[model samples]
Target: MGKLLTLAKEIIFPSRTTCFICGREEIVGEDDLCDACRESIHLCICPPAPLPLDGVSAGLLYTKELHEPMHRFKYRDKVEYAAFFCQYMSIPQDWSIDILCPVPLYYLREMKRTYNQSELLARRISAIYQIPYCRDLLEKTRNTATQTRLNPAQRQRNVQNAFKAAPECKNLSVLLIDDVYTTGATLASCAKELKKQGASKVYALCACKTDN
Candidate 1:
């Protein structure tokens, strides 16, 4: 099914093209946090350690007040929110990221949502870094229950084999993007799949984490 859709897209548009916190309604160009919300938005940036996953960084910490905009970006389709990465990303200019990959959603779920939040984030980063953005490189093969509803162990089981890599990402170093990280189950599972497909290395980036 994913393949058929890919074929259809290839027959149609050949190329794929290219966040925000609180009180700031509109994020300025390439900025995740607006000036009015800068101080507080900085308050939401997540630290880079002990997050149950390594080599992943995020721009915000999901809080009660912070959830509104983040949730809007995710469940709704306010993708312009991804620009918030510009405010918080610290990727070295020489980091030499080979590819930009997004955490994938099960095919049916993506259709219903009309877009994958992570994919949109990746595209924005790809544009900024001038790297290759490959959406099809990781495909979600399952549509399990919401990850948020599952316990940690259950979440691990639910996402197993949920992702598979495309040939284009084989032997490439991929920086995977996601919306949030809670237990790291999803990141590990997706990275494992990319590694299985011969990815040289797999790193992760997300907008936020609950415990961060």
Candidate 2:
């Protein structure tokens, strides 16, 4: 009887998928995550110390196992992974956030990638939470070197003056969304611009964080 039910489920939902992290089929649970992969995820128990942004929150710790999925989502056209990643995100209950703003990509890079991964993640989060999201709230004015190889100071300098906030962001309390938070230089730079444009508060949220 159980085998018959399983077979019927498979036939009815042929597009039912595997775990996003391990690609394990037979995900007999919620959210397309296998038990092992779900158990292995290291969620942030405590939020990071405040930076230029009011606060920071992340869903998972950056681990070697997460590298491939993150890379594929960002650069390998695996946009479908956004839903899996967004499922783990948690917004602060105390934050009176008015909008969601994705950390923007420079035009050339965005064009080359065909889509901004951060925007995709942010939009999914916005849809889930029913919060308005604007991709144009922040704009990357210059193409900078990737932060992956940069030291803390270099990362700070690389993104400095790289972002500009739009007029529409003025006086809005925003939750800025991104894929990863490493040195936090990118988020800080963006926060500075948003504050300059009269945003009341800016909080950062990311899918993954590295120990720094």
Candidate 3:
């Protein structure tokens, strides 16, 4: 009876067994990508960390193939997609991160969305890597314009003074988690606030990075 009930549930609301990238049902791996789509994913070979970030890494290069799914994950309530994305994020051996801090969304924005996508990624990463995560440590204080259409300098200005860090961040090494790394503007702004609150080091990890 239990098996029959479970099978009914599967039939009613299908599980995410299909490849997230190509929607292929054939032998999808644990990351939710079939062999062909998985091979097509371009891993990010990051350059040196920009100012204020001690280190940085990302899982995939943000290609056109990934854009649709990523948009859905962020804006279309595809929250379950966090599990598939976090599987590819790896923490570097050198950074002694004390806590995972998701780059925050403005309270109103989060309230409207019902969840912060970055926080979802951070929680999954913390569970997988056995590292603690603290959403209270950093906060978005301002509802800045979205960085999507902004140029590099404009992106920097948009997030300036947009975040505040808790005093508890003092002396701790923090790893900032976000869905994408584009201009490094948002992460750097968040890192600056953390440092001002006395954080010793800051690093960043993202699900994807634009190939620009």
Which candidate ranks first by lDDT, i.e. highest?
3
lDDT of 1 by residue, 1-212 (tens): 69999999866865422225554345333444455555555423444533223366666666565678778888988877777644555454434568888888888888899999888888887887788888888888877788878888898899888878786778788888888878788888888877777888777777776752
Residue 132 of candidate 3: its Cα lDDT? Answer: 99
Q: Model 2 — TM-score against the truth?
A: 0.89
Q: What does candidate 3's lDDT look like per residue over 1-212, in tens digits?
A: 69999999977875656789887676675677888888889888887877899988998899988998999999999999998788778998988999999999999999999999999999999998899999999989989999999999999999999999999999999999999999899999999999999999999999999998
RMSD of every prediction: 12.9, 3.2, 4.6
Give the higher-lDDT candidate: 1 or 2. Answer: 2
Candidates sorted by lDDT, best first: 3, 2, 1
| Residue pairs with clashing backbones, model 3 | none
- Better candidate number, 1 or 3, judged by lDDT: 3
> How close to the true structure is residue 159 of candidate 3, measured as C-alpha lDDT?
93
Ranking by TM-score: 3, 2, 1
* TM values, all candidates: 0.76, 0.89, 0.89
Cα error, residue 141 of model 3, in Å, equals 0.9
**lDDT over C-alpha atoms for residue 123 of model 3:** 95
lDDT of each: 0.72, 0.87, 0.92
lDDT of 3 at 152: 97
- lDDT score of model 1? 0.72
